[model samples]
Target: MRFERVWWGALSLLAASPAWAADGYSVLGDWPVKATSESGIEAGLKGNLSYDVARFGGADGGAFADDDAWRRQELSAFVRKPGMFELALGYDFRNEVWLDNFVRISGAAGDLRIGQFKTPVGYEESAVSTTATTFMERALPVTAFYAGRRLGADWTYEKIPNWYLNAAVQAGGDLLGDNRGRTLGARAVFNPVKDENQVLHLGLSASNEKRDDDSLRLQVRPEAFLAARRLVDTGALNRVEGIARYGVEAIWQRGPLLLQSEYLRIGVDRDGVADYSADGYYLAASWVLTGEKRGYKSAAFGNLKPRRDWGAVELAARYSHIDLDDAGVALGGRQRDWTFGANWYLGQHFRLQFNYVWAEARRRGTGLDPQIAQLRAQIYF
Candidate 1:
């Protein structure tokens, strides 16, 4: 990406801003480079590193099976014209997935984004930043229905207070060069109440998709990305033609406690078979024990910032279920999960997390259960 060339003269520019200068920065420390040109242009780097280790147990035979990995290693650099627009290039080294490589324009017409970025299909998927997800991973429905990252364009409108609208079109393939499908999505959000100590967000979304091939696979890793296989899998729907996705999400925060939920459904049109359908939903609540609240903006919850030098501590729990059985599609099965988690935000940019999950999956009357515990050390800037 010739990133070095982009920052070749960063030292001189950054040195001009004595107020913005920091002692050190990087994945391991502070944000090293942040500078503004004399003409009001801003340039800087962004990165997020998440390292995970897990232990699997229970009667599922997954016991004694353990794995560790660099869950995500992503870095990006951006140059922006304050209040006007910005250009950013990013990539995830661990998954070899492209992050935000796009051109964003801001003005009276609202935000018009082009290039590779996330599609505004679901509330959690579109609004919540990956670095700030409530848990190690999102709920089942979100993971299965949301279009990750695609080569396309997205438009967002928020000219009216407390109301947001977004629509996007995607073609070709995903960032990883997979899911070669054409997609279109739209979402609308309304914040009935927003104040210093309370906020309520309501949202609805819908999407249509068509893949290059007639075969489609829908699977989800059991709330633990480190797992090698998906316990509930719909191998490959051989006669699929088109797909439709829909979702409803809501979030309410009062003081240090937050409540959130989402329901997502997907429908498939098969050639010789009846239309198939699946749905999933989750309910979660979190409380910040250190008297800190997560910030809210752009229709999403921002990462929590520590108020104390020792940082912030949070406790959360969630229950989720996904049903992939419908229209004679029996083998896809269904899964129900319960997860308890704790997060310790050491600073604005570093965090430690732990999660315990109990997953129950069934297909054609047979069941599989597993207990998993995982930990993550993450840093972001």
Candidate 2:
């Protein structure tokens, strides 16, 4: 929620359009050791560290217990001298103690970041929850669009070579007005199932937000009050004043079992008076009972690697759900949740996480609505 100075000079004057390279980078799940050459200095440093704790309750008197911590403390020293140029700085802290403080400049084709980032939506809220997602909480429609650093500019393109594409646009600050108006996004990833160990994956995404007064829109769940008064008589609150989203994701690991899933949808129209919509999805499975062989990026799904072994241990489970409504436009109130989770890895980098959550609510007269049970422990570095 920070990023000013003419929004960082309008993302440093837009127009650079093309740069993509994420398929590797980890800390709690290992990886991150690349620096054999490029002129040492440990090849310009690297980073990762995390800590988590969670507890939950609700029966009528919602329960409590929460303690969270995370730190990224800077890295990425130098690279220039005509060799793919680079420079980066950091300092991340979170616990409500969410501090960003960043700087970046990359190359090889493109890169020019400028602090407070992370908000591309879908695919487990853009992954990186201490490492390679396996659930420790993140589903509820991707944590209801939780946000990350604020100021932004991210672009990438790969004009066919293995296929890749990305885009990010932003404007920070604003929950009501003053200048909280833009947010557009895009992402596309393809591998089409290459070989070696296994490969087959696909991804797609979209986003649109002009928020300041739509309050993230989409309300009207009082068990559907005449579709929210006929969407407030047709105009749908000036065509859902603002907020739009889209998503899709899939995976298929070739060995040791690892599958994945994702789907999202959101919309709200207030300018037309009131209209709403909502969506959600999830499905997961993991297994590496000591037979190892889960590479291709450590198996989250397809890229290849279905066999191997070591002290190796992998086990995971997941189920998720969500829904929203306001067809009659009485304005917001209808919720759902049914989650289950588990994960453990002792080899990749470090891993241990847990989850047991359940939630449900309905509001029309506020009765028989309230239930929650949560528990979580996650550590990454």
Candidate 3:
């Protein structure tokens, strides 16, 4: 009922709003009002909304037969000045209402940012924005191991050509409260080849976290957009003291073809119990049928652009696997997923995506295979 209301409300708002301009944003709709003082202070408003729907089948039971939801991914405003110092505040209307705020300072050497932002851990998790992902949802491995938004301070150094470094220290909970834990993470990326026609990126990332009184749980869905039930869940492990995660990623692009892969390992330490570890990896490839190559910046892939009046079309496929059973725990099940996706870029701010997923999982001597199909309509300003 509430989800339906929000979904319809977002649709109504989008329909009532003015159309977007060629540059992909309307001065009146996107940057409705912007002002610059003589001292170089500037301010503006920004927001985006996304809606997702899904149908599930082939499961032992009707786990996720049908589901849908609308999310106000980002509704925020920002203020900035000449020295590249800025402040931003927003709310994320996902499953829960939460505040998203941050500050940034830039100088000759590097940039320092403090805010509630996504942690830098995996290539795909850090690179692709939610509004512009190739698939309806991220891979299962990424969802299981990667840390989402956290209140933290991060530093980035990219003054050296073709080299980038990022480091951060963050609280594991949201601004409203904190009960999860604290984390420290770092990443380094080097681009040996960068050009208009080709790009190659190699990166490594690691994180260390101190758990808060055995409250950590690891789980993931079957790469479905609207399904809420996780096929694999480690239900709250006991006496968890700490966790460490490591990842390696690579991306290669030539012309309109792109290939990417990443591997992640997470180790958990417990009190009076044998330590255990879990790992996962994924491989994906995409091709732009409209001859518009995906853009690469700051070690991540940006959104696709339409090259013709008909718009841009992209086809993508992925294979992902995650194994959570280790020396002491067997509850977290193991899963393998194969997904095929298509994306259509009507313009810079409007996109439609479709995905079909086949997932297989084994737990406690039982096996289940599920199939899911999902669609998404996204609009942003």
Say which candidate scores most in lDDT. Answer: 1
Ranking by lDDT: 1, 3, 2
Please give, for residues 278-376, the per-residue lDDT of candidate 1 as tens digits. 899999999999989989988889898877645688999999999888746646889988999999776577777888999988877888788888888
For candidate 1, the lDDT comes to 0.82
What are the runs in model 3 whose C-alpha is more than 4 Å off?
A: 1-42, 59-61, 81-83, 97-100
lDDT of 3 by residue, 145-217 (tens): 9877788899988889999999999985657665467989999999999998999999999998885667568
Better model by TM-score, 1 or 2?
Answer: 1
TM-score of 3: 0.88
TM per candidate? 0.90, 0.30, 0.88
Q: Over the full model, what C-alpha lDDT does candidate 2 score relative to the true structure?
A: 0.49
Error of 3 at 264 (Å): 0.7
lDDT of 2 by residue, 1-381 (tens): 111332333233221211111334322234555555655433444444544443434563232333333323322333333334344444433322233334445466655555545556676656343355555555556555434444567665554655667777877642222335577777787877757666676777777777664455333211111111211111224444767778787877766676877888776555746456677677777666655444543113311122221224456666655555455754334455454554445434444444444455544544233333222222333
The lDDT per prediction is: 0.82, 0.49, 0.79
Worst 10 residues of 1 by lDDT: 1-10
